[model samples]
Target: MSVPISRLHVSHDAPLLRHVSEHASRTDWCYMHADVASAYHPCFSERLLQQMLQTQERIRRNLAADPDPKAGIHHLVLASDSDVFNLGGDLQLFSRLIRGGQRGRLLEYAQLCVEVAFNLHQLYDDRVHSIAVVEGDALGGGFEAALCCHTIIAEEGAGMGFPEVLFDLFPGMGAYTFLTRRVAPVVAERMMLDARVYPVEELLRMGVVDMVVPRGEGRQAARELIRRNQRIGNALRAMNTVRQACNPVTLDELLKVTNEWVDAAMRLNDRGLKTMERLVRAQQRRAQAAAPALTLV
Candidate 1:
């Protein structure tokens, strides 16, 4: 028997939830909500990432148990809070890791991120559609995470970009791989090295964003897109499969870049880490300011 999704507990502390509705359809949208005022942003903690991984595993198992394919989740949507999608990596963690010379731990984090990027990019077996809903700023690793999805549905005022260059490091998890797949390598390189935050509209124009909707409409747009595509779902999946076969995003490449990232991280001087620390403080401030009406969905 299929279990009720609400009762399906992947992790008690996962800071995410599942709901069922017509618009939700065969879609599993997990919205992350947590206090940014905490030293660690909800999205970038080791504990949170582990919970998320467990949740995905559980979801996959549940889907496999379900006999009806259409009744199962056809799409997975990642939603975030209203003000900031994510501030990227936990700067505090990075600062400590870099200073303490915790190379292995840093690599582990990178590997975790790669696993996340690859699994989402593959759409959990290519049978499930994947969409990223960006309602606000998605920076650095956060932007890379969004790009890993098959489609990025962002609000009109949402923003995304790589600010990693400013900190003397690159977004080595999946930015280069995903962005290059979507655009030219030169274009990807320029975008990353420039360190500018691009608006959702500009990204939509550049073909980076699949859809841009009004504020508070990202979830609606994602559901609507899935519904519209359902008519030709078979064809859509077939085309994506063919594309993957032709030019696959390989794990080897992800690991290679991640290793390079760790090495570069070891070379960061005080100046770079200071910049990262400042960013961390900025996140804390944002969390404090938005605490009253802050929400994730």
Candidate 2:
């Protein structure tokens, strides 16, 4: 069940927090939050992906039917939980799938991830701009998910990285695809392979972060950015279109790399699996601790 902004309501099974903020008759912002405290910890679960896809389609249709070029689903901001933005793919799910030799299930999960990321990346073309307001941690696929947005507005002191290399696997999602867009290929390599969480400032300097606001101001910063964009929305949208056209990262490209991720995950030996298992426990613990502050409603 998807929420209709014109007639707003949250589905009983919707994984994320959905809220619509009215700015004016001209613009409406739909904020879909990452609101999960399970092992997924807002990981790209199948449920979350399906709900988000349905929401996106609904917003697109609403906007398309409007007469104003900038009318309908003008902006999409990916908000986060009170703390961590996301910890990455569901490590526990991966462990189970790999241990059970369910390679197909694992690949299907990766495909779902790709579909969400690729769809968000494609939204810039529809006059629907995507921004990720990262307030806390965004690691591995978490970082990749942020990169999918047209703009990433992060809070100062927030951490972001790809720690897949720690377990002998690589972040095969859109990490490289998106990172290289703002920085050099070599620099992108360092961030992924180092597996060390980098400070927001470092990423800002490296050009990965479009804007870094003071801590606790991520959502406000995102809104300010949106307001500024709305002033010259047409120009911004056109430039975004040109930028995307010049260096397009297609769904095919992401799918190819994600499949490679599946292969690497499948080949993980005992030591690597142990490392992954450790992360799974850590993620669950983190989620449990953050539970009091979380609510899907």
- Over 1-297, each residue of candidate 2 has an lDDT whose tens digit, in order, gives 112222223356745756564547234343434454443365655666567666677666766676766543367777765477777887888889999999988887787777777766775355767889888888888898899888898888899999888789999878888889889999998888999998888888888988999998888887777778777777767876787688977877888888898999999998988999998788778778767657543
Q: What TM-score, computed on C-alpha atoms, does each candidate reach? A: 0.88, 0.88
Measured with C-alpha atoms, the lDDT of residue 183 in candidate 2 is 93
Q: What is the Cα-based lDDT of residue 24 in candidate 2?
A: 70
lDDT of 1 by residue, 17-112 (tens): 332324346677766554333333544666555555655666678677777665433777887744667668777888999999999888888887
Q: What are the clash counts of all predictions, listed in order?
A: 0, 0
Model 1 spans > 4 angstroms off: 1-24, 34-43, 68-73, 295-297
The CA root-mean-square deviation of candidate 1, after full C-alpha superposition on the true structure, stands at 4.8
